[model samples]
Each structure stands twice: as C-alpha cells, then as structure tokens.
Target chain A: MAEKLLNWDEVLIGGTIKDPGNSKQYETGSWRVERPVWNPDTCIQCMFCWVYCPDSAIKVDENGKMAGIDYTFCKGCGICVEQCPSKPKSLKMILESQAKGKTEEELRKEVFSSEK
Target chain B: MGKKVALTGNEAAAHAIRQINPDVIAAFPITPSTPIPQTVAQFIADGEMDTELVTVESEHSAMSACIGAAAAGGRVMTATSANGYALMWEMLYIASGMRLPIVMAVVARALSSPLNIHGDHSDIMGGRDTGWIQLISENSQEAYDNIIQAVKIAENKNVMTPALVAQDGFNTSHTIEIWELEEDKKVKEFIGEYQPLYPMLNTDEPVTHGAWAPPNWYFEHKMNQLRGLLDAKDVVEKVGKEFGDVFGRHYGLYETYKLDDAEYVIVAAGSVCGTTKDVIDTLRENGVKAGLLKIRLFRPFPYKELADTLQSAKAIAVLDRVSPAGAQGGPLFTEIRSALYDTQTRAPIVNYTYGLGGRDTQPRHINSVFETLKRIVETGKVEKQFDCLNLRGEWR
Candidate 1:
C-alpha cells in the first residue's frame, strides 16, 4: 500500500462507498493476531467449522466437504476450532509471529501434529 | 384558522408528524415516548396519514431503518425514550455523520437500574454530544411547535443534520394541556417538501454515504460536521422567527425571565421552567431579585447568549434533573460554569441535581433554590456545593 498525502476535508470524508459488500476491499485479516491451522487427516467430513465460523472463514468443496480456511478475510477468530467437535482438536490457533516467512504447507506441519 | 385543543405532549407531537406526512417512521415502543409513535401508527391505521411505518424489533433497528430511509432520499421520523435512545447509540452517530435530516421526538425519561418509568433528563442529556440539534420544550405546545420547526432546521441547506425535540417524560408526555394548534394546511406549508440533495437511486448521479473516514479524512468530516452544527444556530433562529411569524409564538435559543436586573438566578430546562417561572413571580412580589433562565435550544448550545444573560445575576443555581454521577457538577452546570470562565460574569455558580425518576419538582423546591442563591450572594461563598434537591438522604 502506497501512503499518499490528503487534505483535511478530503481525509474526513474518505472513500465511503454506498455500494454493499464493500468489506471485500477492507481485508479484516490484517487485524488477526492468531492464525488457524487445519489438520485434514483427522478432520471429519462434518461441516461444523463451516457452520460456526463467524466470518465464514472455513472454505468447503462443491460436495460440502471441508477444504481449508480463507485467510484473506478469516480474522482468525477461532470459532472453527471451538466447533470442530473432534477429541484432539483438528483445528487450532497458532501465533501469527511464527507464521512469518513460512509457506502455508510448512506452518501446518510445524505447529499442529496429526500423530498426537 | 387555528383551533384551541387539549392534548398531551406526545399526542401533539404525533399531530405534527401527521401534518408532515413523512415518507418513513421507524420506531419501537418505549415508555413515555411510546405514545408518539403509537398515536402516529393509529393515524396511519385510520387512514388519516399515509406513511410507511416500520415497526422495528428494537430501538437499534428503528434508527437503522430511519437511516436507510433518510439516506435513500426520504423524509424520516422516529421516537424513543431512555433505554430505547440508549440502544440507538451507534446509529445516532451514523445518522448525523451522514448528515441525514431525520427528526426524532424524545420523551425524556430516567435510565433504568432498579428500573423506574417516570420523567427525567438522563436520556437526552446522555446523547448531548451525538451531534444532533437538541430542542427542549416546557409543555405540549412547545413540543408541537419545536417538532414542526425541527423539520426546517434539520433540512436547512446549511445544516442537513438530524434533530431531536425533547420534553419531560410523564411530566409533559402524559399530562393534558390546552394548546392552540395551527391549521394542518398552514403547518404543512411551513415545512415544505424535503428535497434530498442526492438520493441513493439517482442513477444519473451516484452518491455514497456511511463510508469509513480514515484518520486524514475523519478529522475533516468531523470538523465539517462541527461547522454544520455551528451554522445550525443561525438556521434555528431563522426558522424560529419564521414559525413565530406564521403561528404567533416566538422562540429563541434560551428564554430569560426577569434576568435583566436579577441579583439571584436559577437556570433549568424542560417542564420545570414553568414551575420556576411561577416561583419567580412570587419572589419578585416579595422584593427578591430572582429570575429564571429556561433553555430551549440545547445543542449548538447558546454559550455566548447564555453567558451574557447570567452576567447580571450575582449568583446562579444551575438545576439539573439528571445526576452528574462523579463530575464537578451536573452537565448543564458544567457547561454554564465553563461558558462563564472567559466571560465578564464572575458570579458564584452552584450545582444541584433534582427530580430524578419522575420525582415532581414543585414551585416550593424551585423557590428554595432561589433562596439558596440569595444566601450565596450575601455571603459570597457557596455552601456545600453540588447537592441533590429534595432527596431523602440525611446528608441532603
């Protein structure tokens, strides 16, 4: 994001679009201090995570099976972890600080082990 | 020609709504102010008025619907009381931030906590900084008149901000009073049809409202809003003059009674002003230089005008119907004292919270406040500053 200078009046009434579904541009994921990691192996096909995520972060396949979290807008609220309904939680929250410079595949295996 | 009629404050305000025949009225039932929307609903049911009444689930939705309707280029109105008004806290800012010309009738009631359903200033006083023009009425007639004028004030090209006409809860809401109501045709003519600057559906010209103002832009919008409110002061006076010219009743930001040469004074708002005036007459008969300052327009508060009026009095007792909780004084007292700081008035000011939860403040209570002012004038010092009037506590 490039920082641009704006005048006082322009700043006060900044970019308020009247159009609906404007939140797509907002990217609330920037507010997340924690990230969700999903273990698809132990994960049951039950879509409870999809049903309970406040932001609808848990993505599902066309057949209604669990896919993964949409981290762009997920906000990392952890509702999916709470509603997972598995003994050892299939979904978990990991510190965002540990997620830096790591690929999605690397972070999942690092913090959450399925063998437990 | 106007006809003399007997009506309660809420009933009279509903009559004003009928005359306006707004495009939308979104409201939920709440104590005291319930009658306002209730009567308006009855009118719509009876086919006396044609308004799309949105019977919302709660006060929050009521304001939310009003905002949508107003933003879509429709004249909008609503009414609520203590908790109902409290519920609309966030929406209130949105309505004003978008500069929607929505008019609301607020039957001022005490907020709940051990829950009492009577008149008090806690409701409207709590929303003082919500950026809506506030008009306080002493009786049914003023409530009727102010609602009609609020339409013009809120819709003024220079102002386009929402407004609320407030009256005491049961004290004014349910109490019957004789008032001369103007002809519907005349009232309708006074408040002309609303011409929305940019309606939402104006396809040729697109407009946006309720956008998030970032730090750079939010401060400017707030400053512009402040300028709009400050400009509303002029628009309020102009509309008041126009209403007086048509209806034969004049109003100003604040009304002063015998304040010119007053040695002792009392300042208050709403229905209590009527009682204070009666006490002032009696005090004057006995050679007490007591006067009363009744606040009518509370928002864009007439700081300069009020400070000028209180300058003549040697001492002033600011009567607040709502508790200050843990402040130096009540809300009104703090404003008055602060306004006088740079002014020529060096009079000792006292603060007293009175009439919480529909507790009746009679003329005697008002007379005692004047007496306290006189004593403070003689001794030149306040006695146990900031006390509650007529409370049952031994310390009081």
Candidate 2:
C-alpha cells in the first residue's frame, strides 16, 4: 500500500526530505486530458516510446521488451506519440474522455483496428 | 583583560575570523569590503589559519559555495557590500531556508541608481525580509564583537538561522579605531566546537536536506522557520550576557543614551548615532531633555523593550539614512511606528530622511531635529511630519 501524503506539521523541518524520491507515491496520471495509445503489433519492438517518454510511463518487461503504457503515472503528455518515427504512426493520442467508458482490451483493439 | 589594538573595521573583523579559524570561507571581493577577504587570505598564506578559502568569481557564487559547504556540516562565512550583496539575493533565501548557520560581514553601502559608492543602510534594509538575523554596528569595536557573537548565535541549537553583521561603509570600515582584542584561547573557549544538527555528510544518520515540498507541507515548514527566527530573541540575549561576562562588553537589541527623564528623543541606528549622542550632550547642558536610541539588531526587532523605553517620551524623531521610496515612511520609521502602536504612551512621532549617498551630517543638523521635537511637544500637535536633513535647499 502507498503511504498517504503528509500535511504541513507532519513533514520534517525546513522541508528536509525524510524519504528521498517519494514522487513515485504521487500518481499524477489522473491529471491527464489526453493520452497516447500504443499498438504493439505495428510497434516493431523499436523501443521509441520507451526512449522518448519524458515520464518513465512506457512499460518494459524484465527482458527489455516494450510492453505498454503505465497509466498510473503517465501524465498523458503524448511525447512518445509525437516522436514515434513510424509510418501510419504506431502511437496515437486520443481524448481521455473517448477512452473512459471502454475496457483496456477494447481500447487496444479499437486503436489498432482504426489504424488499419 | 584583552589586548588593545588599532585597526579598521575590516581588519578587526578579519582578526576575529583569524581567531575562530572556521572550516571554510567562500567569498568574492567588493569595494570597501575587499580588505576583509584579502586579510583573511593573507592569514591563510602565513599559516596563521587553516580555513579552506574558495575565491569565487562573483557574490552569487560566493554565497552558493557557502551554502554548499555549510550544508555539509562546516562552519562557513563570507563578506560583501552594496551591489555584491544584491547579487546574492536569491541564494540568501536558499541558505536560510536550508537552515544553514552561515555568517556574513556586510560593510554597509548605498544601493545604486545614479551610482554612488558610500555608506548608507540601503544594502542591509533591502534584505530585511530575507530571514537572516541582522546586527548593525556603530564602530569597529562593535563590528568585531558582533561577528564573534554571531557565530554562537547562528549555531545555537534552538536558533540555527544565518546571520549578517554590518558596519558603516566608510565611516567605520575605513577609519582606524582603538579596539580591544580578546585573547585567542579565551575567544575560542567562549565559542566551542560547532556540532551541526543533522548535517548532510553524516553517513550514519542517513539524513536529507532541502527537498521540494508540495502545498500540503509548504506552510508548516515556513512556520517552523519563522518559529526558529522568533526563538532567536532569547538566544541572542543569553549569548550577549554570556559574552559580556567573558569579555566585559555588554550588548542588547539597542543602546539608548540619556533617555532617562527625557522629554524629546531621536531614534536612529548605525554610526550616525555617534553624532546624535554628541549633540544630545550639548542639548542636555543647555537644559534640553534630548536622548538617542541606537539600534543594534534590526531583525526580530526588540518590539516590547523598544515600546517600553519610548512610551513615556513626549515626542520622537526617527532619523533614517535612506530614501523612503513611496513607503509610508523609511524602513526604520515603519518598524518604530508599528512597535509603538500597542503601547499606551503615544508620543507624536515624526520621520527625517537624511545623509543619503554619504552626505556629511553635522551636530547642528541633529540639533535641529531635537528643536523640531521640542516644538511638537509644546504645541501638542505634529504640524510637519516628513522632513529631510543636510540637503542643500531652503526650509519652510
């Protein structure tokens, strides 16, 4: 379980960081207005999104294979989509509202089917 | 008793530094204050001291270096004046915000617009809200003494805030004075080894300093910093009394001359208080109840003590040696008025801006202020409020 955010009095004096790199506990991906959808079939295992993402939102397996986007902390900046470097664009941006009511499987199938 | 010697304000401060022999000093050279770092460097060369002096390219870097060294748990210090101080503006907050107990010697000088390089309060007053303890001195002796005491005050566990000791730009910084120097062993005993609390370099403790805080934690950290500053008032007095016990020279938030049973008084700070005191002596001999209050600490202003001292006076004139610049009054006047608001004795106070850009202020100029205060008391009304002294022009 993630630790709750500490209020003013509970925090250390002089803003001294009691636990370094606690930014991981703060899930900022919910602030997204738009998110990039990736299609693994056409991705060619190029690792472009993983390299271009400002946030480490692109997921990679233990074997270093590109998996998918980690929406928990993505922030939906769409930097990977802008720098995909693929014909027909392996990565695409969709309004967060459009993807809201759809399941992850349905959204992935729909993103790939639309490109075809 | 300590040895007696004649040295300029800059040299006196350097002699204090030579005795303390701190771990590190990061400084840049600036006019009127350059001699301090220069003399310290000479001491280091002669093996008189063993401080690691980082000669930076600018005042900003100088302060930056001090912050870095201090955060790593070293006793740090530096010196600058005027424009050099303005350059260190941003880092001043960082140092204090990080709660590093760094000390600085700022030989006060005028801030520039038309380009003047002389003594004034502009440099120090400009940084009033930067969260540093400000100690102003009237002469070379006070300057030396204040710097020595500043070390203990800043390092106090309850009040670990950065401090700056200031002296008059040319009047005190350049002029030679007969100053008593304390024995080195006695001085070091008074300020023992500095054990920084939770320094970054403490490997076993595993501590962190100066991390970014979100809105949830920002307010409380700031309040804690303020608490530390407010708590310094007690520590300042305690250390001052202890210093007097060891060296035989006492200090407080301010020094008042002939204020007892006085009907009219002038409240001012810095070396100008000397001239005001001289005029007060003459005024008293001529049957005038004139007195002067010299401010020693500008930060955490001694509000209660000041109000109690000035409450019974019939009228007051606060002399500021800087431009008002569209404020209700000069900085000193604003603080005085605020401090006196809660007191029952409401002395009709007035402000007089004087000696800007290093103009000479004579005894007659100060006597005129006392005369104006005398008139206000007799008339029971403040007819004229804002005025200037020593300016070349006709007065109404």
Candidate 3:
C-alpha cells in the first residue's frame, strides 16, 4: 500500500512529461522573442533605440554609444531594430532561445541583487 | 493574525469572497477565471469558508443561479471571463433591471476568433451598456479589496444595482503576488449581515419576482436602475473610505500618477495602468512630462472627476483595449471627449486602440504612445485615431 501511494505521487508529479514534439505544452512558446543586435556604424544616435525598447534592454554608455542589450530584461520585441532610422540600419534582431528554467522566486532575487 | 500567503489574483478574489462569507457562490470554470471557483471550492472543502458552492454547467446558468440566490435574500457572488461573460449577456441585463445587487468579478479577457485566452478589456467593454456598475482593478491586491468593497457598494440601500469588478484576465488573474488578506471578523463587521428588500423565497412574505413590465412602467423601472447606478457613486466612495480606514488602503474613483504639471497624460484602465505608470516614471526621468490617469470606477462614468483631473493637460491620450464597431472612436475616447466637451478648459484628446485580443501591451508600447502624444502636442496636428505598436501591415 505504501509502495502504491509512492507510485501515485510519482505519477502525479513526474509521469506527465511527454515527448516535446507531441505535447500540448509545445504551444507554451507563444510569447517567445528573438534577440536584437545593434550596429553602431550606421547609428544616428537619435535615441529612438533607447525610447522604443519595451524592456529597457538597450543601454547607453558613458560616451553615449549604443551599448548592447541586456538579455535578462529584453523580451526581444525588435521595436528598436525595426524603428531604427539609420539608412544602413543601426539595430537588427534574430531569433535566439526561449526564456525558461527560472522560477519567479529566482527572478525576484536576481532583480533585487542587481543594484549591488 | 491570519497567515499571509502569496496568492494569484484568482486566489485573492476567492479569498476575498471567503472573507465576505457569501451565502451562495454560483460559478462556472472559464479560463483566466477558472482558478477562482476552484480555489473557492477548496476553501469550502477545507471548512475555512462556510458557504454553498454551487457548480453550474454554463455561464448563463451560473448567473441565473446568482440572481435566484440574490432574490432569495442570500448574499451571492459569481465570476467569469471573456466568452463566458458573453454567454451571460441576457442575465447580466436582467440582474441589473431587477436591482438584485449581485456582485460578480469579471476577469476581463479577449473575445474569440483566433481563440486567445489572454487578458483584454473586450469582455467588460462588451458589457459596457448593460447598465451594470463596472469597477476596474489594476493588480491582484486591488482585485481582492475591490471584491469586498463591491459587495458593500452594491448592497447599499441607496444603490442596489449589480456590480461587476473587472481585472485583467491572465495578466492580473494568474500572476502571483503578496496580498494583505482582511480578517474575516473585520470584513463581516465592515459589511454587515445581508438583508433583502423583498426576498422571493421568504415563507412569511413570499413575492413574485422578475415579472414582465408594460411600456408605461418599464421606463420607470429603468429609471430606478439609473437612479441606483448614479446613487452608487456616493456609496462606492463612502464604502471605499470606510474600508480604507479599517484596512489602511484607500481608493478613489480615479488615481492620477505624476499628473501635476504634466503636459501630456495617458488615461488607462485595468492592469495596463500598472505598465503605464512604469512608463510614466521613465518618461518623467527623461524630462518627457508624461503622466497617467487610471479610471477605477468606469460606470456612471466619473465624468466630473475625470474632467477636473485632465482639463489642464495640453493633450490627452485615451488608451482603450476595446473598439466600438462602426463608431467614430473607441468607447473611452468618446466618453472622455464628451465629458470635456462643454468645459472651457480642455485639451486636444487622442485615441489609441491597443492590446486588443490579448496582444501583449509592454511598457515600451506605452512609452511610444507617450512619444506620439508629445508629437501631437508639439505639432498641433490632430491625428484622427492611432494604432500604437501593432505588427506592421497586419491591419490590411
């Protein structure tokens, strides 16, 4: 009976993992985003990149050149890359990886510890 | 002291309902709002909330049961979202017309087509003309407190209209947060025992309810409903003040964030207001002079307070999540424009339709909206209507 109860616990917790290709959880990545890249060569420094970044991902350095995105906060909507007014285009975006494997608690800790 | 726990918006709503100790809770399971009933059922089973949890098959039946329970002199509550709320359309109007004072939590979700289960104002906006008092909440904590306050406001003698407490479906409903749960004793003390004016199921004084009315008296009945809704404004403010005094959390009909000396202001409702506040902070830091006006009580439409608050701005951007079909503008924009029409002190108002069908409305989109508003103010060029931060070429 004890062994049966333990088996029941295992089934409730771990036995639900199915093949990723065939699972309904495949639909979980609907909110995924691609990472953005900046090209300072064609940059006009109009602050459009800074203004359009949804996640505050883009940063300006002390000298005011376009510092690369901080991937932690960037949801990669590519608004900065899409809205860049430079003819050659100062910013571009590409599909990267899904943001996973972090619990809410871990994210909160990371957010609080960042100022230090 | 009661224990504090990290609760989702749905859980917080369920916890608040438990605190109210409603005699009847009739609800159906619907996405973004299903967890509320489920959690409330668990509370019932755990003996924490001594109430009847009636499981109904459809949203229509759930609301019907609520009306029945309320008419029978039982304090009743229910919740639904999006498509489920759409299903309860007829009963929603009936509940208001009957002056049932039934309190419902509507977790606002997008209506169907592509079949999205995310958050939007489509559900609540669709029911805007149903004559129900609508209150929008920005976060889980607000969702919890608003439910308790809704019961008080709805059941007040001056206003016996049914109230719909709306929160963002998935964004606020499912997101977890630490909320201060009110003690049951205090809530019971604040919202006293439920009494019915004419309880249908009363054995000593039984009454026939929901009877048909002729045109002669039909208009009078509707006038009563209108009077009740208008009277709700005072009850809502009074109850909110009392609840705040007891719980240390005060709420107003609308809240202005950094609006003092602001050149441009964004008027928003529901959970997006939180994101709007963040963007307003960022814009103020950069000297953009943007501010936010969050509408809490949307029904009987707080026109005086809104006009007084927003009359000083150079330009106002009214962000609406729901669009009125075949109308000249979004629902909120039309109302705001009309509210400020007669006043000499008013600004050029712009309308922006965003986050329709649960499209993710991030802070950046809001910031871009402020940028657009600034341009409108600077150039003095009035754009008829703007769709902010939408995927390019998708509209065609």
Ranking by DockQ: 2, 1, 3
Question: Which of candidates 1 and 2 reaches a greater TM-score?
Answer: 2
TM-score (0 to 1) of chain B for each candidate: 0.98, 0.98, 0.97
Q: Against the unseen true structure, what C-alpha lDDT does each candidate score?
A: 0.88, 0.88, 0.80
Query: Candidate 2: where is the Cα deviation over 4 Å?
Result: A1-11, A33-60, A63-69, A76-116, B394-396
The model with the greatest DockQ is 2
- Candidate rank order under TM-score: 2, 1, 3
Candidate 2 residue-wise lDDT, B1-396, digit = tens: 698999999999999999889899999999789999999999999999999999999999999999989988999999999999999999999888888889999999898887988888888989988889999999999999999999999999878899999998888899899999999899899889999887788877766777776676677778788877877788888888899999999988788899978889899988899899999999889998898888888887888888788966899999888888889789999999998999898889999898887888889999899989988988888987788998878534
TM-score: model 2 vs. ground truth = 0.89
Error of 1 at B284 (Å): 1.3
Instruction: Report per-candidate TM-score of chain A alone.
Output: 0.77, 0.83, 0.52
Pairs of residues at least 3 apart in sequence or in different chains that clash in candidate 1: A11-B216, A11-B217, A12-B217, A12-B218, A12-B221, A16-B211
lDDT of candidate 1 over B1-396, digit per residue (tens): 898899999998999999999999999999989999989999999998999999999999999999999988899999999999999999998888888889999999999986988999999999999999999999999999999999999999888899999999988999999998889899999999899876787766666777766675677678778777888998989999999999999988888998899988889999999999999999899998888889988898989888989888899899999999888888999999999998987888999899999888888888888878878888878876788778888445
* Clash count, candidate 3: 0
What are the root-mean-square deviations of the candidates from the true structure over C-alphas?
Answer: 5.0, 3.2, 28.3
Where is the poorest 10-residue window by lDDT in model 1 chain B? Answer: B211-220
Candidate 3 CA-lDDT value: 0.80
As for candidate 3, its clashing pairs are: none
lDDT of 3 at B217: 44
